[model samples]
Target: MKMDYEQNAKIFKALSDSSRLKIIDILSCGEKCACDILEYFDFTQPTLSHHMKVLSDCGLVEVRKEGLWNYYSLDINNCNKLTLFMMNLVTETKDCICKNKSNCTCK
Candidate 1:
């Protein structure tokens, strides 16, 4: 699939904030209610909600309402896109070591 640079940028920008990054890390384990997420930080409920809003708006996280509580989980497809993008950045060398004997700098 073609990469959406703007969408990826939004996801990264949402993660730029330490609080939001923390939220993502917490949710990475599994879906979590807003209250459970709040317990990990000292921020106010509204503040935590704002962070979640940014994450949801960026498409990096998914939000669902389970009765009185709001639960969140990472958007796996978008997460994979971001992961693959970073992987591509690290694997810039195109040729395999087997293809070149002397100039193969890959380790």
Candidate 2:
């Protein structure tokens, strides 16, 4: 599998901010409009928009426009892909061969 450094980097960079993480957590519960998210903090609309932009650019979240409102939601497909990638990284059998294996076949 080809590692997408750029994509992963974007995810990490976006998540580096606490506010962005909180935003993601909130969105995970359900889709929310920009104004609903803004209610959680004292930040002005522009600041929240910046964070939302970063999240959207990283593919961590997605937005849909309904009339005049922009609703954001967590991108579950991307999140699942990321989760599987991390699981594979830590669970690959090559690294745990004979250390704890009762049957070692790798020569």
Candidate 3:
């Protein structure tokens, strides 16, 4: 599959923050209510909301509403795609070419 750099960059950027990373880890176990996720952090509700928005915007996490509560969980499909893309980026290569044409002895 073709990788969308813009989308991937958004995902990477969303995960750049430590707080966001922790949120992802929390959701890894299973779906969690917003309150449940907030218990693990010292930040305010609004801050948590912001973090969730960023995660959701990047398609890294999903959200659902039941009554007055909001639940969050990791988007497994997107996460798997991100992982595969990263793996391919590191492992797949056509060839290595020397920059110096005068001394191009690479094989």
Which lDDT value does model 3 have at 8?
Answer: 90
* Of candidates 3 and 1, the better by lDDT: 3
TM-scores of the candidates in the order shown:
0.79, 0.79, 0.85
* TM-score, cand. 2 vs. native: 0.79
lDDT of each model, Cα atoms only?
0.84, 0.84, 0.88
Highest TM-score scorer: 3
Question: How big is the positional error of residue 38 in model 3, measured in Å on the Cα after superposition?
Answer: 0.5
Off by over 4 Å in 2: 93-107
lDDT of 1 by residue, 1-107 (tens): 34466877788888889999888899889999999999999989999989999989988889999899999999998788899866665464454333367765566
Count clashing residue pairs per candidate.
0, 0, 0
Candidate number with the higher lDDT (2 or 3): 3
Candidate 2: residue 81 lDDT (0-100): 75
Per-residue accuracy of model 2 over 1-107 as CA lDDT, tens digit each:
44565787778888999999899889989999999999999899999999999999888899999998999999999988777656655675555435457787644
Clashing residue pairs found in predicted model 1: none
lDDT of 3 by residue, 16-103 (tens): 9999999999999999999999999998999999999999999999999999999999999999999987876665333323423658
